[model samples]
Target: MSKQFDLSVMDGMDRREVREYVSSLLWQLRLCDGFWFLNVEKRHGRAEAEAVNGLVWDKMGDLAARDVLERFGPFADTPCGFWKAYEYLPWIPTVECAVEHDAPDAEGVIRGITVTVRRCPAQAGREKHGLEPYECREMHETEFRRFAARVSPSVQVECVQAPPDPTPPEYDCRWRFVLPVGAGGDR
Candidate 1:
């Protein structure tokens, strides 16, 4: 995977590092997702694709959290922790790079943040493939909240917006992260 991604390609170039990284990440995601589909379909069956997607989603969240912890040190379950964790998402570079405009515009509060993906690459890719958006709404309900729960059980994930549903021209998906209604955290 590293071999195909050339850091030198971005060396003092036209300020396109983010673009390069997005391309690299997109290539990687396609490769990994393809491999997962191929093997899982052969070994298990086509019926398990959603399950496999969810499994990979969960593991990726954990791994991303680990990376953030290693780089930024531990964080308490606060709105700040949520922001820090968001930086480690594998999808970040891709989305940030691909969007025509500012992608994840974050509205921050003491105990929560609402992130809106103005343009979703996953949505575009699926459209390009003549496939409908994957069941992200269902996946995020449990898997996304579980991702945040890795930081703290109180952390909540609500799909303010997601795919397989109509979205207006302004945005593709929006996620609200906050402590449960009664959690001690502020905001």
Candidate 2:
């Protein structure tokens, strides 16, 4: 049996022309990397976290290997640059929830960007399914770090808070991105 693939499969945008649409598309845009992960989780449930995360890594790693980001990414391999570039991505922040960023922690002990996601759409969706929001901290740590490395190997990421942890009412998750002194990052 053969399978049929339809252009309408793409979130309702009828892609009537394949060649020109692809030619004009920015393949390394980075938004799909996030959307794919969420869609898999939504369709398969939280148990899919590990699998979806691994797949995201595989896809993202391939981008790194392709030298793809150089053509489209605005990130500069610096903490500030990562946040600035990431914040501008249109759908990710909108789909996930508005993210709040704090650059350079108050003590100045780390020159990095601290990000907060107050209302994660994924978590809300899972909760609606009567499923406990699965743990995503570890998976996201790998995914985000790999994503940053694709832009600039010097960028580092840590998930300060994620699901399965008691998310404070103010935020659902928090992440910190840093460029250590040795990595040509600000001291």
- Considering every candidate listed, which one attains the maximal TM-score? 1
- TM, every model: 0.65, 0.61
Compute the lDDT of residue 26 as modeled in candidate 2.
34
Q: Residue-wise lDDT of candidate 1 within 1-187, one digit each (tens)?
A: 2464566755676647767766777779866766666577568864576677777777777776666666665665754566566656666755632212122223333656677777666666656777665556666566566656666556777677676677776877777776644565432
| CA shift of 154, model 2, Å | 1.2
Residue 51 displacement in candidate 1 (angstroms): 2.6
Per-residue alpha-carbon lDDT of candidate 2 for residues 1-187, written as tens digits (9 for 90 to 100)? 0134455534544556554454344343444544675677678865785566766665654454234454456556677766555544332534444444445554443456677787766576657768677677766677566667656568788878887688887878988787776566433
- What's the lDDT for candidate 1? 0.63
The per-model lDDT (C-alpha) reads 0.63, 0.61
Model number with the top lDDT: 1
Candidate 2 residue-wise lDDT at 30: 42
